[model samples]
Target: MVLAAPLAPAAPASRAPAAAPASVGGVSAAEWTIRWWRWTRSFPDGLEPYLDRDGRRCAMGQDDDGPVWFLAGTDGRFDARRRCRVPAGKHLLVPVINMYFHGPRLGENAMSCAQVKRRAAVNNDYLVSAVVLLDGKPLARPERLISRCFDPQAERDDAGPDDRRGVVRAAADGYWLLLPPLAPGPHRLSVGANYGNPDDPDYGRMLQNFEYELQVGDPAI
Candidate 1:
């Protein structure tokens, strides 16, 4: 059987009780949603407030490689997409996963905030992994750079609210990864999701697994 591989080592257990309802956590899923929403709204200028094609809130940045995108979907949907065009050299890749599905309508896997927090704190249960390949050989692992939170110290004050540097959370309630440089070519990138609590009503309802093909540096791609 395939096991979930986390980029970072397991974090300490969250203070919230395990297996409790979404509302039982120290911060309810709904409440966290509202908090995240308000925080995102106050984003400073040039923070590039916008939704990805899939409706997830995201910001844009740049490294020595090229453009970098960060997704922090308030709804926990965490869906986004873009055109295929690999940079000339190594680039950073950040993938976002909001385990606390927050929205007007609760999703099947919408469980107690504590459970979500636990998933973030102890990611062995819920994880998002990626595999990058060029010419049929693996190039990157999900562990290149992973985090459970977007902004732990609220570093937006120091880095500017719109800066991508402060967008990481300290807890495991969410997942983010900064991958190493990927070679330019016909690369195959796959992002897979396996999240949820078997004891919860929404178990197995939130799992996702998919792949994409990118013709790097190719104008016709």
Candidate 2:
């Protein structure tokens, strides 16, 4: 009789718990979304995490001293697969899909708080689905992660010369997830979302599918 070869071990299950804490490291989930956006815009064009094709730029805007790390979604209607190495013990903030509006920029009229909120919410109103998976296990109650309309101050660096800054009016709303620290090993995370009426291609349609293969420990290992 021929001897059978041993199969490889299965990858460990790394998932975001059903219920996230009220806050992580002194910051609320909602505020974390704002900070996530700021971090996304902190860098210039070539270094924006959202535009990073592969995960090499994952550390572009990271604060060396922060407790949480931010991940990005594609600009619009684009899919990206990335592999990254994250430090162990750091929480991960993922923006499943989100929208924001800041104004009084060049050639633009001032927008009221209500207007900003309304504009920011238009894309989300047509959301068809938003799915997040960690290690192939979906997160429970993804709708619970939706954020209410609120203003987020725009720092000087978060805006351009044509855009207003320093607490300028802004509003954002979308689905966001705060994943707790992962075990010091390999993990997989993916986000998929669809917005707009499929039948009408011109109706501000936006679709995104982002995949992240993460290693939550020293890459040298």
Candidate 3:
């Protein structure tokens, strides 16, 4: 009997990990909720003593304290015992440190500190990337790049062009790029994605023209 043509190999099936029980410091599939209230008694002047409730303050400068308390929670997949307590379901808590920033320009916004710390506490995974450009032009390669993440509230700092928190690459057509780790939510991207020849005064000037606004989340694009 004539043999039929060889059958094509079957495609492998995709599989998702099983949901884990919620714990105080581990990974779990259950959704966790965190409730926080401002300590009005201790912070009578509001979140920032220097800035008014309306988020307006003197340009000269003002004094303010960092985040009040940091809450730590887990999903019971990794470290079972940690600060805070939880039941058999997913558990979430606000970090003891305030990692958000609310100001005249910053507004009430959450930063990566809360997202990364919580994910790590629950054994979750996250990623960050950057897009570089010069004078609005994409680059082929970039030189001198750095990235890192921190609590803007605690640091009392603004995300600047030089801060190491995203990807940075050099371009062949005169554009430098930077991409950084980000969680679901609205994010502000600032880039110094260009370099100038030392002999050319136009060098580094393109940096002033670098700026971008983006949002990332469940429906990330």
Candidate 4:
């Protein structure tokens, strides 16, 4: 009997990243992140896409009548690869490393929208690096893609009534990308980001890294 040599794993296929429009469906990339957050918080605990291990739950909280499809980053524990089927002619909204904050901490009476916005912005302050790739080509100036929004009326159906005396003030900040509709075919999307000062002794942690193997066409095909 002859013994065979061990085979090495192959990398994912690559192509140059396609050019994406500044805004799609009249929504800027910044606004899309807020919309993504609203969509994200709409789901109950186990059903939210951010906590999904595989791509099975990718379609969980999506609207059947929307112009954009939202992709999620994992819970930052490990790298996740998701196999998703995206409908043709739909723009893709991806969250690289985003943060949402709302509060009156433990003993506080109230928190303003500006206070919430500042708290949320802290998570992105020490960003070590963030990247978004199509195929394998990296997007330019990812640091410049930062967005911040304060929503005074933000509410989550799954989370019951607002805890802050009906104020419902909250904020979100992070790096977000809005990609134009891709051609109908198989394509690869990669998104990742890490925050915290590298000089700190405990700074090796990463926020999220996701790999999506997407089929842009009918699933029955």
> Whose lDDT is higher: candidate 3's or candidate 4's?
4
Ranking the candidates on lDDT from highest down gives 2, 4, 1, 3
Candidate whose lDDT is highest: 2
Candidate-wise lDDT, in order: 0.36, 0.66, 0.23, 0.65
Ranking by TM-score: 2, 4, 1, 3
Instruction: List, residue by residue over 124-180, the lDDT tens digit for candidate 2.
Output: 766666667788776743443433333344533344422344535666677777777
lDDT of 1 at 162: 29
Error of 4 at 7 (Å): 29
Error of 2 at 37 (Å): 0.9
User: For model 2, which pairs clash?
Assistant: none
Candidate 3 TM-score, C-alpha based? 0.19
- Number of clashing residue pairs in every model? 16, 0, 42, 0
Lowest lDDT 10-residue stretch of candidate 3: 168-177
How much RMSD separates candidate 4 from the native structure? Answer: 7.8
Worst 10 residues of 1 by lDDT: 15-24
In candidate 3, what are the lDDT values of residues 85-134, reduced to their tens digit? 11112111221111212212222542344344332222111101122222
**In model 4, where do residues sit more than 4 Å from their true spots?**
1-20, 104-108, 143-167, 198-205, 219-221
